[model samples]
Target: MADPTLKAALRGGEFIVAPGIFDMISARMADRMGFAALYATGYGTVASHLGVPDAGIATFTDMVSRMSRFAQGTRTPVIADADTGYGGLLNVRHTVQGYEAGGVTAIQIEDQEVPKKCGHTPGRRVIPAEEMALKIEVAAEARRSDDFLIIARTDARTTLGLDEAIRRGKLYARAGADIIFIESPESEEEMRRIGGEIDAPLLANNVEGGRTPILPAETLKAIGYNVAIFPAIGFLSVARALEGAYAHLRRNGDSHGLETYAFSDMNELMGFPEVWEFDAKWARPERSQAAE
Candidate 1:
């Protein structure tokens, strides 16, 4: 079943701030931080897993595998991005079921065409709003439980305009989406308009360098957004950290002076203590048997 905690939080009227987690390290780290949820970001996952862009090249299997790993490894409820549902209506149904079975608490599906680009980027196109509404209906029906939420995203704001995006958001919500995400509203006023117009729970994309102006959680909440996902923060920070560490190593041949996550702490975070305990328990019995 889906994690009821996420659904409860959404109903609780508090704004949720979900950080993007792309890998086990990110997942485990965020899992302990007490965030309301973790977003298994499609862009970060594709880049980290396949060394490729999030340009619809990653298949359903590729994305779902990562989603399963994230959900299994982390205690926090995960909201995974299912880009374009990977195909048509049948694909949408299958994707929802696959994600639910993989232990994801929620899945965000967009209205973009196949070969979908990132929401904040250009050259992206969306299918008909009616077609996307059907996709949402199929997704909602395919889930085994209502707790497994369906977040409907419209990429129409950047391409068609804010008016069309809002229209699609309302349509998708009526079609059974639990949350409406009108992606990439450029200004605070546009966001406010979205919040006032769309009666359903809304999601704001808070990409650092993307088209949307990054708002404080309080501002987002006051603007009537229920969730704000910072999908690029973790990976972008990691990228900079790696660059600095690698540059230092190349120049000075040592990482001794640099600040880093303690090696032992990392081992513990990754569950090495359990492995050690198991080894110790088994080794003692084997050694005793040998002596006997």
Candidate 2:
């Protein structure tokens, strides 16, 4: 099961749709909802943890700690976004090792420079193709297992153009990367063209309310994408819900009008029933032992 996550995604043209999860609850929820995997989204992590946008503020230690928690919370494979490898070639190697140890099945390292912003956001810059290829080579070599994937992401489309993104993606793939991710294509035609041009297994990043048009998983699969990560859906929706809830609480001094689960219902959702059963089983055995 080392690299079975991506291998299964590549089988039978089944485009794997991994939902972006920032915390353990979201990761477990996505697992219960039966997603193929969980994307440990850097954007979501920064937004959720620091209440800041994904502008490279989070550190490598921060990411590793959170990723470890996410991995511990669920049985699903996690594909982590290792932004710019946290530094140069040596950093890329270290990042891969850390992520692999944290139970990451794949690590996606982008071509954008350190202090990288989100792909959909403006003012993004990428390193030279050869330089990024060297980074990919280092990432591929640093992995502990053959199944652990080295996903090479190029954010050149927003800065240079679609052609340059493809060029860089091909180079990264040739450098022994397992997947080519061309971030934030401007149009559906460009998306199709990327699928056509990049011969490697490809990853499509579908950011919510971002530059790239959100396409269906079936459409992405038909267009030759092996994976699609919706990195902001959970964060955006939860933010909206919390905003409304806070407004209601401030205005009404209570959550009376809001439709929310009862305390017991929420406890069940959080697996309290399982916890209670375990306690009962152990307590009963202890009582029996005491009597004996």
Candidate 3:
């Protein structure tokens, strides 16, 4: 029954819309908006929660905890960024176990070298193809469900180059990756070229303001990629919204500018009524006593 939402989506030829959701509120909103699944964004989480760059500072424990909340909030399948599997091939077994035990549907391990950085980071490097592929094998071997996907992401496009990226992606796929990603390809040509080339279920990273072009969802579906992860879209919206709200308060000593987006509307976005209900219920012992 675990990850049934994700498993069903992966079965059909249609590309899965797995939005990058950082916190529980965003994840629950994504589920309500009819997203088939959730993709945990390492960048978004670090930026939103820690007020830090995604310089590999976010801990695996923090991510797993956030994922647990997301899964509970929506019961939607969550595929998380278990970045570099939090270390090496040896680290992957435990990392996968932690994610599975936390109720995430899948974990994505990347080929970036140890003490890894994000795919868009300039100095990012990948481990040797052979070494990274072994990590993929370990991840799959450790997983309890065939339905629990192991996505092998190769940042080799920016590091070792595209030929090597494709090469490593295939090797990882061969090594037991249920899905494979060639991250941050710069152009539509490369997207089409790579999409045409890979036989395994391919995934795309559609980060806004990244090197990759922002193609429409329908375009990617026609191009045959199985999953498209827009890891920054939700976070970007949140950032812009917060900035707009703060500016209004500072400029006028009021929130008149924020009137365009009401607090009630923002609360609705988070399903805040449910939280209010819980608080209201708990504040009344009479409700609990009456039920008893």
TM-score of each: 0.97, 0.92, 0.90
Candidate 3 C-alpha lDDT tens digits along 20-123: 89877688678777777788888888777888888778778777787667666676788888889888767789888888887888788888776778787799
Best-fitting candidate, measured by TM-score?
1
- What are the runs in model 3 whose C-alpha is more than 4 Å off? 265-292
Between prediction 2 and prediction 3, the one with superior TM-score is 2
Model 1 steric clash pairs:
none
Taking the tens digit of each residue's C-alpha lDDT, what string does model 2 give over 1-292? Answer: 2447666666556678899998766886787887777899998898778888888898888888887778766788888888999998898889888988888888889998878998888899988999999998998889888878889999999879888999998999999998889998989999999999889999988888899898988888888888999989888888888899999999999988797547886677678999999988877556768799
Per-model lDDT: 0.94, 0.86, 0.82
Sorting all predicted structures by lDDT, with the top scorer first, yields 1, 2, 3
**lDDT per residue (tens digit) for residues 239-291 in model 1:** 99999999999999998788988999999999999999998887755676879
RMSD of each: 1.3, 2.6, 3.4
Total backbone clashes of candidate 1, pairs 3 or more residues apart or in separate chains: 0
Candidate 2: what lDDT? Answer: 0.86
Full-model lDDT, candidate 1: 0.94
Of 2 and 3, the candidate ranking higher by lDDT:
2
Model 3 C-alpha RMSD vs. true structure (Å) is 3.4
